[model samples]
Target: MEEIFDDPTNEHRKQELGGKDPSPPELLKKIEQLKVELVQKEEKLLEIDLLYEHVSRLTDKIRTAAESGRHNTLLLAKRTNELQKKIKDRTQKMMALTAELSMRQALAIKLQQEMRDKEHFLMVVSSRMDQGLPLPQETESEWLKILRNEKIRSEAAEARARHAAEEAAATAAGGVCSAAQRRPAVYIPDSDYSLPLPRPYGALAPFKPPEPSSHMRHYRKPIIKPTEI
Candidate 1:
């Protein structure tokens, strides 16, 4: 039985050996071709490395360009800011000058108004004089008399006013005088209150108070009461 199994195995081995194709020379040729392909592949890898180096240099140039562009942009922004500041400053100065000009214009207008008022007053006076109206009693002689009277009256008035004002000032400044001491015994006449009356023909007559009516005039006739008789 062993010989029978061994016989089939030997026969199968013989058939496999007979059917197998010889491949040693083909494998050697394939190995030599693979070595050539590997050499070409190594050359391609070297070319790829050089391309990578060129790409790196190009990337660095791009980075430099980007940085330069950023710097230029920053410089432009700074210049814009400075220009804006200058414009703002100029605008403020213009506003200040405009305000000053407005103030000056207002002052000029006020002065013009004052001048117009003065001119109007003068014109009114001249027109009244031209209309043959009686002028105010301020003639040279009358004025001289008025001035002399005013000088005397003013001297007296100033003395009284000064005394009163000084007393008031002293009281207000914490003077030691009592109330009774503060007031002095003095008598003033009603006649002393008289002011110079203007003539009826004078220009200032229109401004004076109306004279008393005839019915309102005072008389010295005595009243006869029964008890007095």
Candidate 2:
């Protein structure tokens, strides 16, 4: 059993091939080789430590960059939201202004039609009077209503002209007017239109009132004469 367990090559070499223990030179060579391997292991350990430190520095830089990115991202999101809110508000204001403009245009068209019809009616009445025909009775209520409408329109036009002039003066002076201006509201007799006045919107110019027609030149006097009597 001992023979089986023992190394066969070493003993057989000593007996048959006359092999001996390694020489001093061979032993020294092996020791030197082992020392070289030890130095290589030390250098490899030092390199690993340097690489570890470098990796730690890189990780720290990446972490700082990531934190800065997060802060910047939050700031950007907040600014973007504020800008969007402003845009939404402006959009709503623009839509409201557009609706107001359409309403004003419709009102103007209706007023123009009424003016044309009144002009035609006045022409007929004037012709009848010129021919010495029987005149219709003057309507006090109707005349009062017409005067009220004309006064309102005139006031509104004046207001708009003043506003434009003030704006222009303010511009030339590089400042704005702080004066609170009042707008004229249409007061229809027994109607619910008394508050919402027309704003000074349109070109940067004074509002010019329509020119008085020749037929309308003698209209107010006849109506007033009848009312006084």
Candidate 3:
């Protein structure tokens, strides 16, 4: 076991391979070589430190740029969301305004139609008055008062005409009726009707048939022809 542990070279040769008891010249040469290696190691350590410092500065710059990019992206996303919300609000407002405009337009059309109908009614009333037709039944209104006045004027004119006709008849039959104490009877002739008399002023306007809608036009009552018995 001792032999297995021991070196194969002699003590003198071992001294040249850095043994504890080395020769003076050998020791001096080894020391010089070690000193050279130490100097080289120091130079390598300085180069490594400089490389590490450069790498650290580059890493710091990259980290700062990444953080700035992240902040910018977050800001951009927030602005995009705000713009979307504003657009949504504007779209809703536009829709509401459009609906309101449509409703107002419909109301205006209805009001115009009512006004036209009222104007037409007034025209009919005036035409009826010009034609000596009785006015329609209505509440106590300005048109009703005008119609009453017209009726009174017409009755008064008819009364005057009757009185004139009676006077003419009496003058013609005066001699014949001289023996009779009673007044002479007068007769007036009319082609289409009896003598003109003051009729009661209780008549209404002439009836006007209503225009039928498309749906009701097809269901009208048919006229029956007269048949011989």
Best candidate per lDDT, number?
A: 2
Which rank order by TM-score, best down to worst?
2, 1, 3
Superior candidate under TM-score, 2 versus 3: 2
Which residue pairs collide in model 1, if any? Answer: none
What's the lDDT for all of these models? 0.79, 0.83, 0.81
Off by over 4 Å in 2: 1-23, 131-229
Model 2, span 1-229: residue lDDT tens: 5664485764543435676899999999999999999999999999999999999999999999999999999999999999999999999999999999999999999999999998987887898889998555564567788999999999999999998998899989997667655434333234486545545444443545666888887666644444564
Writing each residue's lDDT as its tens digit, candidate 1 over 144-214 gives 99899999998999998987887788789997534443322233334656655432433332243566778
Deviation in Å, model 1, residue 190 alpha carbon: 44
Question: How well is each residue in 1-229 modelled by candidate 3, as lDDT tens digits?
Answer: 4664485754543334554787999999999999999999999999999999999999999999999999999999999999999999999999999999999999999999999998998899889989998887672376779999999999999998986777778788873323334522433344476657534333443345566778976796889999999
Which pairs of residues have clashing backbones in candidate 3? none
What lDDT score is found at residue 182 in candidate 3? 51
